[model samples]
Target: MDITQLVYFIKIVECDFNLTLAAEKVHITQSALSQVVSNFENGEGILLFTRKNGRLNELTPAGHVLYRYALEIVQKHQEMLKAIKNEANKLVGSVRIGIPPTLLRSYFIPFLPEFISHHKNIGIEIIEQSANELKALLLDNALDIAVLVQPAALNKNQFEEYSIRLGEYAAYMSIHHDLAELDKIDWSDLKGYPVGTFQKSLTSYHIVLKKLKHAFPKAKIQFTSTSWEYLLETTKDSNKIVIMPIMPKKSAKQNYFLQKKFKESLSFDIGLYRPLKSFYNPAEIILHGALIDFFNSGIMK
Candidate 1:
């Protein structure tokens, strides 16, 4: 039945079968209300009400069923309206975000608390995966946004980009290690010790791997873990170096974790990637703004 007829039917029942009162409440003439309900009954092919001697009485069984379904449909329509209004009033929605593992530790994890607290109604899901997997997920509609490292070496058509151009990170060796004695360690310096890093799939890892042949062609690759904790624990005794951005002074309180910038640095752009067409969503805008604000206020950049 049409919305107007459904509303008229509901009003007729709610006003206790008083056609005069129902029509008065809905600001429609009694004849118009009666005619509308008559049209609805004809379209539905069922009698909605029993009229006996100019008095409308109780509904038939079929009428009761239609009324119940009609109530549900009207309620659902109202709910949809409420949801739209709520979305417009405040940024509130679910957004799935994919980020590579290394960034989750050093970037996303540390900044999450503030974002969560501020946007209490907007739910953010963070999927930790490699950059390649994240790109695929974004294209598949499995993810709303992603923070990936560039140059992704993938097709530009797949993702729209928001570059969080935090500066270069250096290949760092331990302070007590022999390479640390030099003000600058070149490609030749990393030759002897075991090479350690997050994962070979990452953008930064590939960059360093490219230069490894120029410096230490014979270097052995060992101790690969996605966890930052593994690097912290292993670096104490193993003297294995990894490439990372210099941690800010606030993190200097962590005794084992020391960082320094180098002349020979690997530049990285922490990127926010999503299907370009989806960026207009309000939830996406709020999240992107939050990330930009978080990094800008901090010393990590």
Candidate 2:
């Protein structure tokens, strides 16, 4: 039954079957409340209250069952209305977000505390995925938003994106490596050393690999890994160079692992992605605002 009928049903029981008292408690006329009870009993094909001299008396077995369920429905309906009212006043909901593992520490870690404090009602669900996987999730609507390295090319017809920041490919090497002393190194300079990088499943890995191979066809890439730790470890001890996105200084404290800027940098367009939409919920609007504020704070600089 609808909420109004459920409420009236509960009120009648609470008023001890007094039609006048129940109707007055519920701000309705006595005859109107009596007719509501009659219509409900007729609709369900069950006698509710026993009649004594044409007056409502004790409840029947069917009436007792309806009373129990009616109480529950009325209570839950009140809660639902309260929740909707709260949502109208403030952001209140959950948002599924996808982020690259590498960017979590650099980008989100610095700003999450303050953002979370400001929007306590908003629940955040974080998913870690590669850039390619994140893009797929956005397209499928499995994720509400994704913080990923922007694709080299985007189809505006399918997706909407905003660039929050930019990154670049850098060669990370051990301090003992001869090239570590250089101010800038070119792709040709990496020929003397083996390179370690992420696997082909990552869009960033694929983009940089294509450029590397185009410049130096004979260049040897000795290692490929999906784990960031494996690539970082390889570059921390030997002359092997790891080609990857430049990590924020706060994220990389290993002085032994030196970073050499690329002479001709392959820039990474990093930003937020969402399915193209004209409207967003209050929670999504707050999340977008947090991201913009974090990026513009110049903490990354």
Candidate 3:
């Protein structure tokens, strides 16, 4: 009946009719959420869910009909509020952005101080996770935008992408390692060495693993980690080769390890991606533009 009830209804459906999960997502107690649903159904004189052994099974026919309208109503209501706030001031709302841990430390951290200084009124929440995890969050509407190491195949229709930088997967080794003497290393050169890279949650892990396996089926990938620093530090003193995207200029200069590009050019685009949505809030719009301008200006290069 009301917007809050409609939101709860939508959340319940999104949680696959699991009331407990829906309640947790909405930050309400299960009993309170059940009361809201009961009140709504009683007031409407209709059953929204089909019950199986006292558990929510699925949406009823009438529930399906209401769901479509509820989604539109809630979306429109949110858009109206965002529009009003945007008109009052273009940079007022909080924008949630997701970034992989590696990229955040090497690339985005440098840009944040400038962005925050310029738009002090706008709030920025950064969610650090793997590229794959960030993609899921972006699609779920939990993130306004994300910086992803763009997959070779992406659902272009589902997302709007802006290229931030192009980088290539490279071998990093300690200066004392034999491979460090080479300006460019071939995949075959890494054959017998102990390899280390990112965890399975990251796109870089899959891409590098595929290449390594194809080049040398017996490739010894000895370490996998979520932290780039950990991966670097773990291999820095050993003969182990860490495969990752080429480090940012500042980091490359400061780090003790040396980088060597692959002979085959294993490359990826670091991009800003957002779900293709009908409405974008003022903060999202401003941040998107600023990001594009910042990257294009060669400031982060």
Indicate which candidate wins on lDDT: 3
TM-score of 3: 0.65
Q: What is the lDDT of every predicted structure here?
A: 0.73, 0.81, 0.84
Which candidate should be chosen as best, given TM-score against the real structure? 3
lDDT-superior candidate, 2 or 3: 3
Candidate 1 lDDT at 76 equals: 88
What digit string (tens of lDDT, one per residue) describes model 2 on residues 14-35?
Answer: 8888999999998999999999
lDDT tens digits, residues 226-263, model 3? 87788878666789889887777777774678878888
Ranking by lDDT: 3, 2, 1
Instruction: Give the residue spans of candidate 3 off by over 4 A.
Output: 1-91, 152-158
List candidate 1 stretches off by more than 4 Å: 1-91, 153-158, 172-175, 296-298
